[model samples]
Target: MKRYPTVLTIAGSDSGGGAGIQADLKTFAALGAYGTAAITALTAQNTQGVRAIHAVPAAFLREQLEAVFEDITIDAVKIGMINTVDVVEVIAGVLDRFQPPFVVFDPVMVATSGAKLILDETVGVLKTQLFPRATLITPNLDEARMLLKKPIESVDQMREAAEELIAQGCRAVLLKGGHLVAARLYDVLAVRGEATQVFESEYIASKNVHGTGCTLSSAIATYLALGHALTEAVSLAKAYVSGAIQAGKDITTGQGSGPLNHSYAPKPMQIRS
Candidate 1:
């Protein structure tokens, strides 16, 4: 007998269908993984900016996690847009109970349109309670600056930042360098005892990159569920996101930052015995 390689995305909902849970689910389906979600909050936003946010209660969030874990055989997990410390704790507890194989935490601090998402206090809780539980924490340059409380201006600084983030108890860190002012984009991956690795990609000039972080992390989790190792998964995921951006470069979805073409190359769900 065979079953789909399922991934659970414990994140928030985006009414505009660009980022947050919407992007996660879209990436999962595009990469051929069965997608599941336990929403932590709801945001009324578009490609322009966030208007309002309604957080899901901790009890209901726990119920959602239990309901999914009790039924599906989850292969990998992706976490995004956690709004409160309560939601963070609830998710940490549930993850501790289920112990999924892969947990990619996208520490989404700010939206692409310069809107803050998570609270300052919640960031501390996430670092303490959820960092150790996460398989890899993917933070953009700005988020890294918030976490490290310093500047990461150059490639060498990014590598140093990745190492410092791993010291915060996470097993590994993928410090994104999209914000760096350079011709080519670079991302550093630092594992606990392994040597750091750098991934370089051509800088595609496109405004439709609103959900690149959410999409990349979810794609990495999907590749992990599909049996790729950590480094391999990141490489494949970067390629997928680059392709999505290039494919949707000319298309216009909203007045502000648009979204990547997640379904640019859809694949059928994969089966596992």
Candidate 2:
């Protein structure tokens, strides 16, 4: 029997089902990979905003990671929303020990409602421990600005910020430009000592961009698990996300910012034969 490529999400649980582990699993299934998760925290949140967050203990988080690594074959990983410095350190230790083939990190700091998800101290831990281990780090404009400790208001500035992040030990950086003022959306992918790749698409005016960054990173992990090159995985993920945004434009899920149609380019799961 041929086994399906498996992708894992080591992140928080979103009760809203629009982001975090839920979104990552949906994206993996839609992209033809089997999905697994090791939740680091539980968040009581909806489309409007996050109301409460209860973080799991670091030891419990480690147990979850060990359980998956001991049994399942995880081909790739997508990490999001580690709320504390301890949790971040625990995850970093696990990843360093196991070393998954492809790891995509979505540095989720602020929620759609403008509430901070990760504590300030945790950001430093993330930069020092986790960023260097990621195959790709996806940060939106605001998140990038915070990480670089500077303002990024233009394409030129975005390029420079990406360079700075690469210097900070990230293998590659995908600086999302959705927050910039432009008719077209631009995301810059920069790898160390390589030319930057710009991915551009027509800006689709829609309110259904809730979990876009999470979905994109998950999609890229799925494609990477399926043997696609890094550049190809990112390119395909961008197209998939754009289609999902367009598909869910008018459809309203909640009162606030809604989620993207993760199944926009759905593929059948690769069943074992």
Candidate 3:
């Protein structure tokens, strides 16, 4: 029997269908990887904002992980929207045991609409325990500031923040500059012992940007599962997201911020040779 790259996303469920596990699954399918998920929370959310969050029991979350690991060879894993320290601990435990080849962590601390998605105290554990295990951790300006306890308002600051995050023990950091007001968007990738690589794209103007961070991180995982180098995976993922945003830029979905066009141009499944 033929096999293919498989990716797992550990995140919350978004009823909006634009972000969280929904976006991760769409991104994985679009990028030619089999997708699996272990949802950590069930969020009452939509395009506008998150109303409430119901976190799954950490034991139940662990069970979900065991089920996937027992039968699937997860080539890569992308983590998002882990709302509590318990969930963080659960993820760290399973990952340490299985040790996937690539892990992309999008620290989903805040929502696109400025709602807080996690407890403030959980940030400390995430940095010390979770970030260090990731192949790359993608954080936008607000999330970066929250993690660093300061402001990051420019590309230069983003570069500095990326390095600082690396100092916290992560293998690499991808500081997203999407919130910086600029003609171009620059995402800084700082890997240990390697020169920083800046990935750029023309910033598309649109409200359909919800789930973009999740999408990018998941795409990175998918490409990594497909055997792309870390930098190449990041580059391809950014391009994929930019195209997805442009494809649905003018279209309207919900009354608030809508989702990216993840399936705008899908790729065929990749079969392992």
Candidate of highest lDDT: 1
Estimate, for each residue in 32-149, the C-alpha lDDT of model 2 and write its tens digit.
Answer: 9999999988999999999999999999999999999988888999999888988888888888888899999999999878989988989989998999999999999989988888
Q: Which residue pairs in candidate 2 collide?
A: none
Which stretches of model 1 miss by more than 4 angstroms?
none
Worst 10 residues of 3 by lDDT: 148-157
Error of 3 at 244 (Å): 0.2
lDDT value for model 1: 0.94
Note the Cα lDDT for every prediction shown.
0.94, 0.91, 0.93
| Candidates 1 and 2, the one with greater lDDT | 1
Ranking by lDDT: 1, 3, 2
RMSD of each: 0.7, 1.2, 0.8
Which ranges in model 2 have alpha carbons more than 4 Å from their true place? 271-273
Clashing residue pairs in candidate 1 (N, C-alpha, C atoms within 3 angstroms): none
Tens-digit lDDT track for model 1 on 90-202?
Answer: 99889999899999999999998898998889989999999999999999999999999999999999999999988878899999999998899999999999999999999
